[model samples]
Target: MTNITLQYLTQEQVDQFYRDGYLRLPHFLSPDETEALLTRARQLLSDFSVEDHPLTKFTTGDDNHVGDDYFLTSGDKIRYFLEEEAIDKDGKLTRPKEKAVNKIGHGLHELDPAYRKVTLENPAIKGVARDLRFHHDPVALQSMVICKQQHIGGEVPEHNDSTFLYTDPPSALGFWIPLEKCTAENGALSFLPGSHLTAPITKRFVRLPQGGTGFEELIPPGQAPAHPEGKYTLEACEPGDLVLIHGSVLHKSEKNRSPATRFAYTFHMIESAPHAVYDAKNWLQPTPALPFSRVLDDGPNASVHPAAGRV
Candidate 1:
């Protein structure tokens, strides 16, 4: 929930973006900015702890919150994750504490400087880190993903950000930021070259049929795929470097057999617009299978919750 205005863009940067559809913005957030976001995220988790966290209904963890099977499939889990559970409304998690909030969930993204909205990833969510499954931001066409890997096998899958999500043409930007040092051993991202500039790629995705792994690959293979020049490997990055990507790009994460958790954060960006949630004009929306991030409209002086201005 950082309060940031889009003012740092330069002519050269814009040109690069036009050429590649994405550009890396290193050290965009100062240390203070990043820390402030971490604080806010921790605060939210603390509050969820105090209150009877109601979002537990949508989770079914097999290995603690590390690997959860949700009743809601296809859509992004955030929608169902945040929804008030009709059944287990009592926020008490049935799963062990190890699964409740994993250490990796601490990878917080430093959004606009104000640090207003922070994306929270529980162990259950990260445990499902099998594949991106090819989707995109709908209206805002922007999202941020952050994480820290404590296990040696935490990896991210690859796919076009908008392959099956939307077809309005690539106007979305994907930003990957690291909270901790990222190296090949720690699990960095690998991408395809000039793939983002090519026309939108669309094809029916048929899984292995027997459900090999939930979060394995973002793009489940269907028919033959165009051989987009797969010639890009993101350079290893330091603690504060960020990789900005185009929505049309094809990318995936590498192996992470390291002893410690690989900590990183990601954000999806779309041009500012109105009525963005469900409109087709935007192509980055999640596929028919994933849930969607609804359009949020808060009236004047609105606090995140209705409790604000209450007394």
Candidate 2:
């Protein structure tokens, strides 16, 4: 791979991230780059045949509804999930694969060349990881293409990324890129700005070693509800825009009711600390089951979890 230099974030941008718990890049990618990503997404979807495909539905809970081998093994492979509501009462698909697919997910960055080039090897991404001041290297752990399918796209409830990708001391960071125009009408993300600074992660969604999934809470849910006066703001974005989110930020997207699909690519990263033992129960383990890739090399005070409180 050729060496690539990324544009560094300005002091103002850095300040904004520290203050707001998130940062938005208006033009993170050029028009051609956006087109290339979209093309790659379409091609992947088209190339996947529906025949004998294990149809999984999008769910936010820890439990795997399908519990099938395909769904279980997809942690390191490209796979598809069908929109739950897209199935009829007769238990048959209501639409064809092109429209019925919920998303192509869970591992595109590690498995697909196009996605890998832009996400894992991209300079801008590496730069952001460094700017965040991680202690150890920044390791990219999970990747997915979220498809907010027209009309049937489901709502994702407010939750933090660390709840699913927990480490001994929380370290997850999210990189979300919209592949097309995202508007309120099409399920744009709404965030509770600055929530990360105050709200502590309460629970974790984990995959049990004995074979299923469950939640482990640091504190009960009652202690961590959004502030009574907290303001939730929606961010409408165009293709190529990137949304970098703190692991503990509270955010969600509403169900899509429009005719157009809202396609976006997303991934998560964590500080690769020798002292940080990733919870054995966390989902998305490394392939060969080794450690996650170190995308960015160094920084200061890397851990994201609180040291002495009821977080």
Candidate 3:
């Protein structure tokens, strides 16, 4: 009989993620697990299609992330995403569903062992029509998985994440999980290794393609791509590996020229403490299920709710 111990992240790996603003861990998901998730992704997409009113108006990334596709709170775009996935109908996610969604939005942080993540068609998610401008999570940790890859000219253009949640230095991190083999030829995520160390810059706008509504191209809707000045790395990874990155890390991928379309999910996790970015006042009570596992500060009253005002 043979015995094997499950391997956890090493000190060096954790250090690297901090030093480089990102880290690539191979076999984070077993090959079998990756394949299973891919199969599930296809099923989810098909379920939406079965309704004849797919989540979006169009096919691919171009269809999703558009208004009338899902309803959201005035300022809670992330809540809108969860609604799109859980609800049955498309128009203005109703009160009943919104209530359920609000639970996910407000309480998702405390949900431990949280596997909740969002999907993107790359083309739609990174397109001008979808409002996927650049932004970072205010909390800590988040991730993405590829359900389908884009073969078309819609690659994730270069930009930094700074538009989503609000936090300094970005305590949140992103995970790029590939259900399919991700190679340089297939428009893999290209990152600016250590850019997360500095302050995040204000995103500029990019020009839109034809039939343009002046949507975002790089980070902001209605903007041009921003290029970072530093060393860049386009990781060559297999289906089972996941790329964990700092929220401030500059990342972007080119248009997929290969025949295969890219499909994946992305999520961001919020941390309670400071990494590089600093902003303790804005920290939510404490979301137990941020995208990654983070260190917690121990204190006499650590067990008390963060918002209870119990120091």
Candidate 4:
């Protein structure tokens, strides 16, 4: 008999996710919760100083190196990066702090109390992970608040999360939630349904031990696997909507041209199994390879596996 405790999503929802490679939950957060997040986001934006902020353009179009000191040192701390295009010829911010930032990230779930209370630390998250039936226990990997700045929000090219956080057999998933409304004008996500079924990871973003970063291709150049044509779908999201994206899905968002800002919080999870291996060169790993947050409690005799070293 199936255990009742493992049920978070209905069987239909689960089946739909596997079939389409994505799932949308409209009421993932309450209006009150959404408002709180929005307020917090605004405060963070307003308070963030631009005097020494690193201009980090948000890009996922092609495999690019991210070996700067700022990028390498930000995995465990709350830091802000500026929109690359928003800088003036003098290499300074062209707009105020409120409109110049690109993202605040890579650690909100573990460092921010507000985020942790509603996400990683929430029981529902673990329950959902259990229901997903991951190959091994799932652990929260990377967390960030995507600040889709008005008029300067950059485009995010189609790519899979596994390309950046790959496991030996490829196990990764995303949890994205908007704190404000997201629309086509403000760069909402557009996905190719069932893309995960056909699309294979093309390359990986890796970093050298000494310094620098680059792509490690898995397939021949220009011959990467692709999904079927004319299957594109765009989502118009409300403040509380949640999106679950599969690791192999092909998805992207356009540049925000609207005057409104589209802010969202997102994070990814991966399996921590003895057989799973994380490449030592991945760009976003914690420097010391700390144990990631576990989705399931370690029962009696539950021991940490070797794969836990990379998470």
Candidate 5:
């Protein structure tokens, strides 16, 4: 693992994050570090077999959200999800499995060495969390490598991170790092500035009581604040750049129509203090064997392996 000293955000940068609800830091990771992650992701995609694997497609639209056992139970395990367009009408894959996968998610930070080094072992990430005033020992969860595959990548609808990873006081934050140059043609992220201050987390994605998943309303009907329109700023980033996303910020990315693919690693951190209650019904829940990893205090036991057949 590469040794990275603690890198705290400047006062101006912290101010910008609060004012705009997002911050882009150039060269957050070295070129070699970024390439290492991309290589590992490609290797995992190549090694994953589709013989008996369920072709679960990940979607972010209002309707057709993923609610299968594979998705709901992936919180403590590393698993793959396919692109919506990768499947044909006959319920078969339209392309090779490696090219069809949309993402590998939910436990990479704790289960995979490459991701663990950058997320848990890197002092830079801890420093950033501290700079943001997440003094409550923020717990990192829901790590994923989003492969915006070429030509067949699907579009992500506008949404907030807190909708999926809800905390009682709603203190979720996202760390997004692209492994390749992100461009608008290849599905770069676009953010609605300052929406975090105005937008309310009115609904949360949760595991349904009877099984599967559904969205539960957090506020009374018609009581949510209105979202702003037509002000999304595209954030095209390089391989080593880092984007800090506020939990309530409205953001989305377009389909990758270009020949190039956009591979990015992302994860969320939520306050774990007594005041910030993590809902038990949240779609992603930590198991007793594999609890959520703390950004700071990565002791000897920070890394652990999932049980047999879990990953």
Candidate 6:
């Protein structure tokens, strides 16, 4: 295994993160590494059989949230979700399977070699975690390759990562890497600057007692500060650029109406210290067979979990 020294963040950068709620680092991944992940994502999409799929469409809107058994149990398995606009009235895909799918998610960090390489084994990521003062071991989970397909991709509402992956102190941090150039036309992310410090997590996306999923209130609605529309700043990125998103930061992306597709790989990490409790009601959970991997537990190049046989 290769030995890697933890790279600490500069004081300026640290201050910026605390102030802005996000940091965009250019050229964080090599060209080869970026291409490898893109290729792997395409391969996964091609290999997935749409014939037997449950046609679960991923939605973050208040009315049609996905909470089926396939989606709930997908925390440990590789699963594909379709875009809401991709399915026709007759329950068939309007485009090819590759173009119709919205994302492949929730386990790539632990199951795929390509994803694991950039996630668990990446020295720079480990360094970032250390610099961020994650005193306890950070547990990485909810890996995903979001396919913002051309024309048919759906819009994502403004939300915080912690609302979905909640912990006691709200330590979820997102590492987002775009495989292709992201632009305003192709669904690049727009963030509400400094919202991490201002926006309190008042609701959580959780499994409902009746069996599906719903948002449970953490606090009364009127207490939290309102997120006004005009403050968002659009961030366009290229391949290899890394966007670090704070857990409480408010962010969202528009529909991909351009001719090009935007592919991005992302994963979240939460502190696993005894005090930072991971909520049991969170949609994504760890099982005995596929527990969340600690970021610093393995050596720089060591594999935290055996790669899945499929990829």
In candidate 5, what are the lDDT values of residues 1-311, reduced to their tens digit?
A: 42223258886787788878899999999999999999999999998888878889998777678999999889888899999999999889998998999999989999999999999888899878866663356889779999999998889888999889988878788999999999989999999998877788888998889988888998888877666655899999999899998888899999999999999999999877574789789989899989987776842222111110000
Model 1 lDDT per residue over 127-151, tens place:
1111111122222333433333334
Judge candidate 3 against the unseen true structure and give its global Cα lDDT, from 0 to 1.
0.42
| Model 5 spans > 4 angstroms off | 1-7, 298-311
Better of 2 and 5 by TM-score: 5
lDDT of 1 at 174: 59
Cα lDDT tens digits for candidate 6, 1-311 = 33334366675676677777888888999999999999999999999999899999998797678899999999898999999999999998999999998999889999999999999889888888766553357789789999999998789899998888888877788999999999999999999987776678888889998899999888787876676445899999999899988888899999999999999999998877574788689888899999998887643322211110000
Question: What shift in Å separates residue 147 of candidate 4 from its native position after superposition?
Answer: 1.1
User: Which candidate tops lDDT?
Assistant: 5
Per-candidate total of colliding backbone pairs: 43, 1, 49, 0, 0, 0
lDDT of each: 0.41, 0.76, 0.42, 0.76, 0.85, 0.84
Descending-TM-score candidate ranking: 5, 6, 4, 2, 3, 1
Q: Lowest-scoring 10 consecutive residues by lDDT in candidate 1?
A: 302-311
For candidate 2, the per-residue lDDT at 226 reads 59
Residue 145, candidate 2: C-alpha displacement in angstroms: 0.6
- TM-score for every candidate vs. truth? 0.53, 0.88, 0.54, 0.89, 0.92, 0.92
Compared with the true structure, model 4 gives a TM-score of 0.89
What is residue 25's positional error in candidate 4, in angstroms?
0.9
Global lDDT of model 1: 0.41
- Candidate order by decreasing lDDT: 5, 6, 2, 4, 3, 1
Residue-level error in angstroms, candidate 1, position 97: 4.7
Ten contiguous residues with the weakest lDDT in model 3: 124-133
